[model samples]
Target: MSRRILRGFSRDEFVSCRERAGFPSRADLARAADISVGAVYAWETGSATPQVDTLLKVAAVMGVSISDLVVVAENDRHLGDLRVFAGLTQPQLAKAVGMSTTALGALERAEVARLRPDVAAKLAEALDRTVGEIEAAYERTRKRPPGVAS
Candidate 1:
């Protein structure tokens, strides 16, 4: 069987998440994710993307989700704004979702490339809002026309 290599990672999302999380450097994030510094660099540069398992680990360590690291849509809520409205800080809200402060910050800023449904559940629970509300916030931020694929 021939294995095809594909590269479609979101560099901005990776960097934004790392920087927001205060990893200090790419090496620090790599160490935390138990991956090589080169791998981190590769993802950030869009040279390569991690497989699902690795991506999950990366998300766990970064306190984000696969969607946050890879998905791209225009209409997203300032996750931080929701937290603020609910009277919480990044660390506080992150704890509610078992995520990192940086991850929360990235979500709030919409710096993440995508927002997955599962992650939305966590955010919804943490923010004391319904999942539909959260979804609506993201939906409002989308730049798509009706029924268009984002």
Candidate 2:
């Protein structure tokens, strides 16, 4: 599938944050982030979005939260957005929370009518959201049209 930047990941914000964090160059940020400079360039240029793992490292090095790197409104966030905010790949998160990637994807796409309470608890813990927030996001996802994103 295509690698679209999760909604709310601002390249300009990333650049500004990097600068504010005192990294004078992408190479410097890369070194601090323990990733390739090319990756930084790619993300900045919108040629590619950074992986969750890479973004996680970069966020740590820059002393910013993942949400700082990718800004989403609290109420607007959905399951997919929660995953991204946690800096986890779908597979990674699925594995952590003991769900199939397909199932997670389905939830993200609002393929189901409602989230199971147990599943919601798992997702909440994994994504660092409250159960109510998870349910609310799921509701938002359900209300949104398919092919849309948060």
TM-score top scorer: 2
Q: Give the TM-score of candidate 2.
A: 0.87
Compared with the true structure, model 1 gives a TM-score of 0.44
Clashes of each: 6, 0
lDDT of 2: 0.84
* Candidate 2 segments exceeding 4 Å error: 1-4
Q: TM-score each candidate.
A: 0.44, 0.87
What is the C-alpha lDDT profile of model 2 across 1-103, one tens digit per residue? Answer: 4333567778988999999999989999998878999989998998877867778889999999888778788878877888888788888888988988888
Candidate 2 total steric clashes: 0
In model 2, state the lDDT of residue 83: 85
